[model samples]
Target chain A: MWTRIRDFDRMIQAMDLFNSRLGGVFENYQRPRLSAGTWGVTESGPRTNMYDTGENLEIRVEVPGIKKEDLSVKLQGNYLEIRGTRKAENPEGYTAHRVERGETSFTRSFTLPSEVDAGKVEASLKDGILTLILGKAEPAKPKQIVIS
Target chain B: MSERQDVTVREEALSERNRQIPTVAPLVDIVENENEILLFADMPGVDKNNISINIDNGRLALSGVREVKPVGAVIWEEFADVEYRRTFSVPQSIDVAKVNAELKEGVLLLHLPKAESAKPRQIEIKVG
Candidate 1:
């Protein structure tokens, strides 16, 4: 029983250490900082989701407060690139108390695992989410042989 | 008074349920003027139909459900299914009845007007 208790105590300490490290990572992710501009690029990148539908692949990205006219999507071979900028607009007579959102731009690129039909790509933006559907290229079927 | 108490309890329960979901606190920008206060929150994938906003016991709560994924085999994902939730303490000077909100392109804009009593007024100087 004493040995079991000691093991449990060690486990709890390990968990506590892990939790503190996770907290530090989260804090860094949540904190916003200002940095010098580099060739008109923003430091932070938007979060994304990608899925495979057997026949097609879909990619979704979160980009809030940006107009559709400002976004650009391009596909080069198996790589897909999305770029956009969110402009800052503040009312004239208001005093800001907390300013977490700002004018920023990002360019994110993804390399698809499978070859896609470039002609069949479709993109849409709704509720600040951009979705891209890329149809996969038809794969060559294996040949079957019958022998006596 | 009991009815008000019941409402508070119900709201608390709802907030507790909101906490149970996989939620992310959205980035917000708050501004204040003499007439009103404005709050802007970035909540991607949330639409007007899926968002809830309420003020109870001087707490302003915002919650929304975002359907980020479709039915498919996820090959790669940087973010999981996310719900958005955030709360702020509202001052007594706010006129709750006049509060207004608008959702556009997954961003929420909230306007909380100040009470009449809280507005600044200048008294006329009497000439002797």
Candidate 2:
């Protein structure tokens, strides 16, 4: 009973951590910008979507104005990490009347809900959206029982 | 005058037409220089073919449709099926005929050039 209770406590703690991290990601985008300063570098991460399709788990991340060459994705164990940088450029001889966009670099990580085949993962970037398709690992099947 | 009337008519038409559509205003950055003004809007999932920009009576209207394509049954979903629409009241000094637009990586960039009268002119100094 003690061991089971301890395990349950650990699971709760893990879940709490995940929830806080997810909340932080959302808060970064929602934080109000300071109106007094010239645009500073912003550190908000990309908005992301994760969904399962039984056979594969798909992740879509919104990263507008970033090039494909600037992004990197890695899968370590069950954790998937996405990192990217977007460089800002202001046109020459231009006086900026209103500047809301800035240079940004972000890293976001997520834990998978099920086992994934690392070798079969695929990623692509289109229209500033990064898509990741991860194949699920096959579960072991039980042997058939004969009734005689 | 006629311009004001045109703007009011366009606003009425836009609101009436988009009443039933699910749309969201995209985040935008507007910058102005001596020669032109640049506008950037973030519209993820939008393609070049589905984006439209119209300028009428100093009103710049932008609209984009993003089609979501799912391969299989979705067990979970976070994104929504929302289109994008936004309009800006441009200054009369903008040369609408020379405006240029480009859509890249789901972002829309519009460049509005200044008219000859609005551009800065340098005066030559004569020493006698």
Candidate 3:
């Protein structure tokens, strides 16, 4: 009986180890068990955050190790599309032991809550993050109504 | 003994759940050569002041924090403020004083040079 109890304890510990190994496997189908990169975004696309203000809409994306020349953006009405490719950064003639930083092509798109002026859109890149400021169209801008 | 083990297991699981900021290990690449070891890590949106590197007793620790501040209301968010943490065990022969690091496009490049005594040397043979 004592031996069986000890076996039970071992089994429990083994199960715990197994669970940890499978960490976040079913959390998101697009995300691998191990993060693709530091961002931990979906494989088909980079992680993105969108915000809406009265005058404009702001969109931020995590795109590390990517060059400005390799990224492209498109805007039409309220639709926005982003495409980029992260080429391998491995230095020539260097032997790699572990390569985990994400280096893959991805395409991501989004629809804004209101129409935006493509001509007035402003985009900037800093520290590998992309920020887009889209000016809302005149008709879409929030308006206040005064009571008489 | 089993009772104590059960308590420890529960405590470990609860600690991560209560953390306000999620912590993740940054993806890295390790390469080595005859002179030094080169390590590259991906850390986007992290400022230079937020990165910390520590080496002690044959262990190296790297950590960085990314803070995201958004204006107005959020429509959808797939990422946010996070803490990047990772550690590695390095050889004691590494020249800690001579170690060099640089950041480019949110990627960190670290060079750990080997001490002169640890570098490989070729011996000469003479006929007597």
The number of the candidate with the highest DockQ is 3
Report every candidate's CA lDDT.
0.76, 0.72, 0.78
lDDT of 1 by residue, A33-102 (tens): 3231111124557777788877788898888888899899999989988999888867889999997888
Worst 10 residues of 1 chain A by lDDT: A33-42
TM-score (chain A only) of candidate 2 = 0.64
CAPRI-style class, candidate 2? incorrect
How does model 3 fare in lDDT? 0.78
DockQ comparisons of all candidates to the true complex: 0.30, 0.20, 0.41
Compared with the true structure, what per-residue lDDT tens digits does model 3 show for residues B52-92?
99998989999888888887899877677777778999898
Looking at candidate 2 chain A, the ten consecutive residues that score lowest on lDDT are A33-42
Model 3 scores a TM of 0.78
Alpha carbon deviation, residue B82, candidate 1 (Å):
2.1
RMSD of each: 9.8, 14.8, 7.2
Quick one: best lDDT, which candidate? 3
Tell me which residue pairs clash in candidate 3.
Answer: none
Write model 2 residue lDDT over B53-97, tens digit each, in one string: 999988999988777677565654445455677789999999989
Clashing pairs in 1: none
Chain A TM-scores for all candidates read 0.66, 0.64, 0.73
Which candidate tops TM-score?
3
